[model samples]
Target: MPPSRQPGFENTRSNEYWFCFSSPNVESHLIISISENHYLALAKGPLVEDHVLIVPVEHMPSTLSLSSEFEVELCQFQNSLQRYCKSQGKEVIFLEWVFIRATHANLQAIPIPSSKAVIVEKAFNLASQKMGFKFVSKNFDSISDGRKFLKTQADEESSLSYAEISGGIILLHHVEEKVRFLAQFGCEVGI
Candidate 1:
């Protein structure tokens, strides 16, 4: 079953509410929505444009504890967004993370050029440094160990597949670098 709706809320539009937040580092703007009891937003991060964050509306410590329904909704929303991006002629890069200390679970999606693999790699390295988390580069065969690493973190244990972590970081860095690149195109990132 879906989580109960928060009290004192009227059905304004389609079972969800969207709110836009002011972002300092992004000029394109950040628009957020509370839909189906989850937090959904569009953000223009540093490395890529049209970045989106999809999170649980209620405070949840980690992805490991998310209800099955929330997981389904998240996946459905992600797929729909990816389709939308594809229709726009941009490839969507999906990223998900369970930060031990953060109260909410997060998933980020960024649009990037198909040929920027090297730049994506560099961005991953930079994200590792900024977040103070070790970045491990590995292939599919080494994913089990990676899951173990996340499982041992102090605050909570959440498993992350190698593909998930690698792809997630790449998307993050791509968004982080978007603003600087946008300048060359004569567009300013307002926030």
Candidate 2:
């Protein structure tokens, strides 16, 4: 049997009271609604003060389970957010952690200074090397390539779109199911 819902709450994702938009908790943190079914909220536990979380109205287990239509919507939002972040002189890193029991699909957008932005990829690559997997760089000669790579790679079970930003996209897959602890899944890697 599925878990029981709290009294008087309907459509709460994973029974998380905060997932209900009507709840004051959700209302207070909302930054913008991307579409009828998607919204961006100020992350409650942000890596940076302005870190934003792009979330779907309905609960999604993970990006692995998102529909093609939703995927397109996410892409459009990312592009729009990237441009806005760039104009503000801030570089944003979009990260998604696809795990087994994710209550909602929350894509994180974190901004840092321009100088740090230039070395963000290097940090990610170094972290991957420390973790023992050679980070694969997707062919990002064009924006379309990044889209294609994300669509193809993440479609596979338990895979990752590792990192996607204005710079490019790095894709990875988790082949070992038992290895579930993603040390820094939702946080920025250190310098």
Candidate 3:
């Protein structure tokens, strides 16, 4: 049987409730691994092969809202994915889109051929420019450092998107309240 749902919550639209990641009833088979506070799972309807998600077990609104402990675990997961992809002669890109009304936070990990890895940043930059937004970029020695930087920039209410490309480059774009964002922007530009 599936998890029980409250009445009038069919749309599953709020940050307060109805999270797919937190529900074991549906995606149990999709989970690849679980850490102390998070889970690594194969992304549903992945845009490409080996696409996965790193998600917090508890319903967190966004990565920016993650606690320091969660951040450490998240980084560990990222590093593991990076190493795995590297071993397979691929490069990994991690994309996190934190919407204003985001329910469960998830970071999408995408693996691409090493040959095409060079264009990841350029493609994202071009997309940003065309969409009338600018990405503020910074290079970190590790994903942990990058997460710390992102936390410093986040407050109670922040809507943003960021991509952590292989080799420790982080490109961040703050999403304005009035502007519309493509939920599949990362998938569209990644491939």
RMSD of each: 10.7, 4.3, 5.1
Worst 10 residues of 3 by lDDT: 1-10
Q: In lDDT terms, how accurate is model 3?
A: 0.79
Candidate 1 lDDT, tens digit per residue, 26-141?
22234455577566676544355677776665555444356667766665776676677767776555554443323345556566655553365555556456645444554333
Worst 10 residues of 1 by lDDT: 182-191
As a TM-score, model 1 comes out at 0.49
Question: What's model 2's lDDT at 42?
Answer: 82
Task: Candidate 2: list runs displaced more than 4 Å.
Answer: 1-13, 17-28, 141-144, 155-161, 173-175
lDDT of 2 by residue, 16-98 (tens): 54544544556544565658667788887677767887777676655545677877777677777778878888878877776
lDDT: which is higher, 1 or 3?
Answer: 3
* Highest lDDT scorer: 3
Total backbone clashes of model 2? 0
- Model 1 segments more than 4 A misplaced: 1-29, 44-46, 117-191
TM-scores of the models, in the order given = 0.49, 0.77, 0.86
